[model samples]
Target chain A: MAPIRTAIIGLSSTATTSWASAAHLPYLLSARGRAKYQIVALCNSSVESAKRAIEVFKLPPETKAYGNPQDVADDKDIDLVVVSTRVDVHYETALPSVKAGKQVFVEWPLAHDVAHAKELVDAARVAGGRTLVGNQGREAPPIVKVKQLLEQGSIGKVFSSEVRAFGGTVDREALLPGLKYFTDRAIGGNIVTIGVGHLFDQVQYVIGEFQNIQSQLQLQRPNVLLRDPSTKKVVETVKSNVPDLIIIDGTLAASQIATDGANVLFRFRRGQQFPGDPALSWTINGEKGEIRLQAFGGSSLHAGSYGAPVTIEVHDFASDQVQKSEWSWQSWQEELAIVGRSVGVLYDKFAEGEFEGAPSFETALVRHEQLATVLAGWDEK
Target chain B: MAPIRTAIIGLSSTATTSWASAAHLPYLLSARGRAKYQIVALCNSSVESAKRAIEVFKLPPETKAYGNPQDVADDKDIDLVVVSTRVDVHYETALPSVKAGKQVFVEWPLAHDVAHAKELVDAARVAGGRTLVGNQGREAPPIVKVKQLLEQGSIGKVFSSEVRAFGGTVDREALLPGLKYFTDRAIGGNIVTIGVGHLFDQVQYVIGEFQNIQSQLQLQRPNVLLRDPSTKKVVETVKSNVPDLIIIDGTLAASQIATDGANVLFRFRRGQQFPGDPALSWTINGEKGEIRLQAFGGSSLHAGSYGAPVTIEVHDFASDQVQKSEWSWQSWQEELAIVGRSVGVLYDKFAEGEFEGAPSFETALVRHEQLATVLAGWDEK
Candidate 1:
């Protein structure tokens, strides 16, 4: 099968380095199996930025650069549109692509608000274009193993689940640039919408739907030090209206007629210490056995220092023993080996132009709804 | 120094086997630094049970047996009274000794209700006697190491925490005969009081005070099979009034006067499977590094069965590495080694008859109050 030609919209940090450089370009250039893909175009709000990304990532000389999202979406040769723009632009970028009958893969939050996310979901459904949201953890191998173990009754009927994802502040100046959307409530930039939204998608994707939710959101650090990009000096103070921390407590009602009696306790925080951060830990208890995933990665503040390797601990009751698996990813290749397998499935679906019944977009909207509810509550508080 | 004579107030399953036989007796009898403490008397509600325990544990032939709690409490030769009775009798049996100025070590949930617990705490305070609540996890080595690491700023400023403890049902017949008090609203024997209460004590003891709390409780299993003890036959059905599961999302207000933020997420459930149960999984994320502890023992149903050893994983950013510690009987002994050092100080106090403030009774009552608030909310639901 011919490789699915892809283009990235929104030339952000994740677009320039993380998604385009680390994940998409490499996966597109080297992916094996029936679902090979390639990056053929680059799109950003500015023509100069698009040209820089093309040059920096060494895209093929024939690959085109577009200043507007519609130009890339309207391109006839593009099979997939990857949106790694600011949270506010996700809907604007992906909506055109969905309408153009091209597959869409948007970074987490899917859209800045629930209304926009709902609109994108609706558009994609009507257009019959496949959609994928960047809930990367759900695509990781450890998560796949967890899903398999739950199916095999490794922990019995899962009665409860606890998930936490916490870290210090993101380098806002380096990442956000002219876009202060992360600190702006109007733009839906906050820990709850971005970080928690990403994690909630993985939680529901792995466990099931959350029936009801009661949450507390707090903007822990109101005054953030914004640094000058060139000199790395404190340039100004950015006032953050969005919540830096979010906690939710609720029950997972019986999904598909299986009242497994599960309760969820989740928390996500920012500007907090990253090491020994409990918010990054997760444990799922079932009737047969339990599974735990401990996150111990280093902080980005210290350059590219690696955190602790992800460890999988499984308890087998009948044998009265515990088994463990540990994997190390010192390079992009190793990390890709874990992320590629699952993301590849969605890519294949997108390449075939079969996106009407995809679960990813709906799942992403559910996460956005949860984030909106949390953010709305924060505003009220 | 003369040996501190000890007497048991309840000779039940946990007392006769695990605590008295496996833990206390061997430690008291063979301990190198514990030669000053001797098992002088054994007592239960029934003299027959007391005699059986004495003989089975190979206590001195002159060891007296008593069927009355007051008899054991007032025994002049007894220096320390170990109360391991049902939650109902805890206040009744231990209060007299506490009032008599005898040292006391009572099992968890100091009393059945918050009011009774308060009375005991008040009595112990007025008596000016030393008391120890059997929240042994505080004394566990892994927990001790975590405390040490935190004190050394291993994880930096702790900003958030996630703790999960769940497992399959306890042998309802074997472990819960006295658990009727747990199911009765009047007695406060629900998961909030017993399970979450026990966990809260350990967490608060380690982390500090919880300034406020909000929780959701669920009676997932409304009916349970009541089995006959002797013949192991189905006796009758018992309607459950208390929740088998609980989820709590709250903040432990920064008590350290430090310039940082923190959040805590805790969960407890009954239907969780065993063997591979993440026994007492906890993570504390601070500014410097993250410390994670994964307790590997199964639930109460499968504890100490042929299962994986409980382990603690520590990821110190200062070191840029992860370290793991395993649990074993030897590990328990190492824990005792530290407890033994404290015991040495305790023995000196015993000899001088100079009791330190008995604050545990009050602490237990505070916990009971928290439980009452949770239970009252559960009832309203």
Candidate 2:
């Protein structure tokens, strides 16, 4: 019944604020997470930083400090290794842990490329290591509700679906210093593999997986203005080859068998401005009625759809009533930071020894392969 | 400048309530209509019935009663002839007026067949007579608003669009007695030609017309149950050969030339059960943002999308606001009936000599030809 002993790479000290420091650490330190996970070691780019992390985050004196990922992965006391680093460094940091036979959780854009991601998947499989990636889609409460309703036939034989959303990746006027490399499509980290990939996974998770699909990707906005972090002024206009627009039209396998056959029309744009933003609108049209999810502001398909105030509306012909889904996330909200509540749910699943479909390294590998196919198909026409 | 003198063929008296009586008569009798149109004649199955119509409807003493459509069409004082009869008889009732050089308004499904509709178009063109058919789509206020918004670049460069709705036909339990003959597709008055035809016209009206398209039609519901007039009980079940489901995917010429092409995914289902009714949900995904129309009740593609309570929502990325269209129908709603208000708008268009897109016979012929293509294509696939 002891908690899973854990070590985290790129663990910044409390003196600095970062995604790793803000999103998962607080949850792990909370009452519910406290009973389930125990931090046993820390690794930073250097030993000085790792030592400072122990003091700043106030970890136990016995907790080891390591300067590199391999040292942390080699520690005998650690049962799980967590990698929280830049996309370019994910392979180097996570590969060691997979080889060490420790359960690992890596944040997404699973790796720099399919080759690196494949290496990680192969290592984990050979070592029989448990894995998790931060896909965090199935954990969203609204997604869960929608999936349940569809399975229960709330709309009665769904025939078609449509979605129009913003990936929020091309917010050119609002880029942080660290995101400059992300704009380079060469990094394999644009909206397609990151922002939209999360949403796409959710679509496949909620609706059935796509049996056949054809897609068009367009980089409509050629030049993007990067804002200065301190002065908040446009400093540089970067040429972006990464696609800001994605259009997909294909039939769902479920609908293909029905005499009427159902399909999907999905459009995800990049850099949705606030005033003119239609955050996310998805509709499942069925034989009896429809279930619609319209998020008014900042609602992305990935983690953002679970943010407070996401709306789920159902117009049921059988019941002859339009109803809004009712849900609660008090526990999640209590422990939440800027990161979404689904991460906590992710932690809970990992704690319960559940790994399937929870963004495991294997899941990320399959998604990476799908992304390669989409990128390849975009050039066919 | 004088009020357009009008004669109505098959105009039922107030002793019997019909679609014309409930939807148009009230509007025509209103003060605004009184100043613009003068009813000069009425035609019925017989002279006695015509006399009863005059007495029951309380027409002015100047109004003449006739036993046949030919007599009404031949009247020198009648500048316009309105035909409100069964589909099988539309050609017979309106053909004389076309030859007589009177501006004529005929109910939808302009004729029992495409050949007949083409004949009417040809006859009207040769006679140089204005003609209106009851497509009644552009006349709907919401449709007009959507078209105006799209034209104004409300959602810039619409690259993709989707619509999932029902034809509202094959609603075995919701049919009235007069619609009994419509169940027979051989008459060319079924959902494919009527329900979906109305919606398809509206789609083209808002977006640019489809430059190229293909379709699939299915007779999903093979049999329909008819309800009794007096008891509202299932009185009989009849076999149906007409298709109640239509699926179309095609590119709008607008998107084909743009870097990101705009396309449409449309599905019209039949026999949608209610309390779970999903009548209509349309999403136009563009470069700037999206405009969505979601109807709760019987919001089919035809006249239903323009009903007062129909919801039109817009997320304009340019404006940075998600908004619901604020529209008023004071002119039409003031004359609203238990049926709907679109009919009054249709009447207004006919009276004002605005024949361009107000469901003109030419437009109806085009739609009929389009329907023929769809039926032919359905067989091909």
Candidate 3:
């Protein structure tokens, strides 16, 4: 029962702004994570970058430094490989780890697109590799509470649900230098695929998978300016093909329990939320009641990341009363970085052999395929 | 303009319970309405019923009583005919009035089916008759403000809009004796056609018509109990084929100004609003700002009907400020019944010959056709 040795790819040094540093490191470096997981290696685009990250983050001196995904995959001591890079590089890194029979964890999107995601899923199955996809929504407190309420019939039979949300954290009119590549659709990491995709996964995870979907994706904002944060000067204006607005309506897959194919209506607009309102407003309508989740600052339900505060309420039809739902996270989660709390919960579940409760590569494949269909349909349009 | 002598068909005497009495009589009997309209005749299923209504409502002794629609339509002294009966009778009553070349006003739904609605539209066109459809949403104060703001570019170029609404006033588990017929799909006066239909017209009035629509209509509550209100006793349990849940998403018709084919997502559920929440929540997302309208207590946007209070706010992205919108109604409208405010406005517009500002039979046809398409698709499924 030795701690599982882990190697993290693309673990950046800039803790103030980097996703991997801010979201992943805080949890893995914590006492709870220390007892369950041991950092064995760091992988970057080059050996120098890997060594620099190790030095800047003050990792153990014996931690192996690797220049590429293959080098990390070949490290016999590493029991787990975590792919924490741009979505476009997900398949390149995770596929090698899966083929090498290491437990793999890839940040959501699974890969740049469906074809690559499918290949990784196929590779994992062939190698009999246990895998996890970084869709933290599966462990988010509000999402978990909603799912439990639904299963317990707190709302009776859900007939329909609707979500109106602000989709992106980036300023509507511009972006910062390091984040400018987010405006490019080709990287497969724009708002539609990553930001909205996460929210969509949360919806399906709470209720059920969509049986059929019809969507309209609009490139409402086609040109975006990239500026330097310190100088506050525009460096470049880039053309964007990604859609800033998305409207989807569909029916949930039918279930054995009382005509469970509920209707769904979702709309997401890129940019900040309206001045005084929550960024995310979701309502699940049922025969005997309703459950509403409102996140004030950020629409993406990555727990409290993006500085959003969430409130969950259930309105029971018979009693004509609305009750606030109370949920709790591990005390250690509060000690981790805000963005890393859900990740920490996820890691805890993984350590306790709660694989079924977490989303696997196959789970990621379903979401990835749904998004791929949406994007493909938009391209055809 | 000698008060456009009018004949009202099916003006029920049950002022506290009847739609025509509660919604129409209050306005028509008012001082302002009296100055523009004079009741020349009363039409009902029987001449005795018509006489009873006129007597109970205390109309002038000279008011003629008629047994059928043809009797009112044939009266040369009558210049206007108002049909306020059930949906199934709309075509029968309004058709003869249109063919007789008298201005006609029909409560919304227009007819029981699309073919009947089409015939009425064609008949009105061929007869050169002026017609009004009782869609009061066109004149609701909040709707007026939203429309005005959109026209004035208060929210900039609109990219998308979302509406989540409670679609019916009836209790989810049961219905009253007088309203039991509403559960019958064959009558075509259920939540889908009347409740949700009214809200749909309000959306299209502010934005443009849907260019393409995808909808899922569900009859989640198939067997609803009918009860006697006073005794709280179950009268009957009837099977309902009508949809109690509806989800629609689509793209607006293309416009010349700033790629104006905005995305729309709409969801409506029958029965009461969730406790402590507004029955209707609408958001129009734009480039520079967002406009939100929230109606508490009732979902139907018939001004203050159903005792719902509405608030309209605009969030300017540039200023990051939320501003409440102010709108006004005619002074005389305050004296009418609560549910009759918007109806009073519509009547005022019609009397002023401001036909463009009021919804005509042609306008109702477009809404009816859209709903027809939705119902047809659901039936096919």
The model with the greatest DockQ is 3
Pairs of colliding residues, candidate 3: none
Lowest lDDT sum, 10 consecutive residues, model 3 chain B, at: B252-261
DockQ for every model comes to 0.20, 0.13, 0.64
Error of 3 at B246 (Å): 1.4
- RMSD per candidate (Å) reads 7.0, 5.8, 2.1
Model 3 chain A: weakest 10-residue lDDT segment is A252-261
- Relative to the unseen true structure, what is the C-alpha lDDT of residue B312 in candidate 2, on a scale of 0 to 100? 81
Q: For residues B1-381, what per-residue lDDT tens digits would candidate 1 score against the true structure?
A: 777788877765435444434434444555542566777887787888788777876778898988777787778889888787666788888888898888887877688887788888888888887777655545444555666666666656666676766643453222244355555656655556656775676676666666547777766556666666677666666777767777665666665521233666677676444444466677776655567776565422111322454556767655667777453344324444333332233333444554532226766778778777876876775
Candidate 1 lDDT by residue in tens digits, A157-245: 76677776655345322224443556677786555665666567666777877777888665545667676667777766788776666
Separately for all candidates shown, the number of backbone clashes (residues 3 or more apart, or on different chains) is: 31, 21, 0
DockQ of 2: 0.13
For TM-score, candidate 1 versus 2, the one ahead is: 2
- Weakest lDDT window of 10 consecutive positions for candidate 1 chain B: B298-307
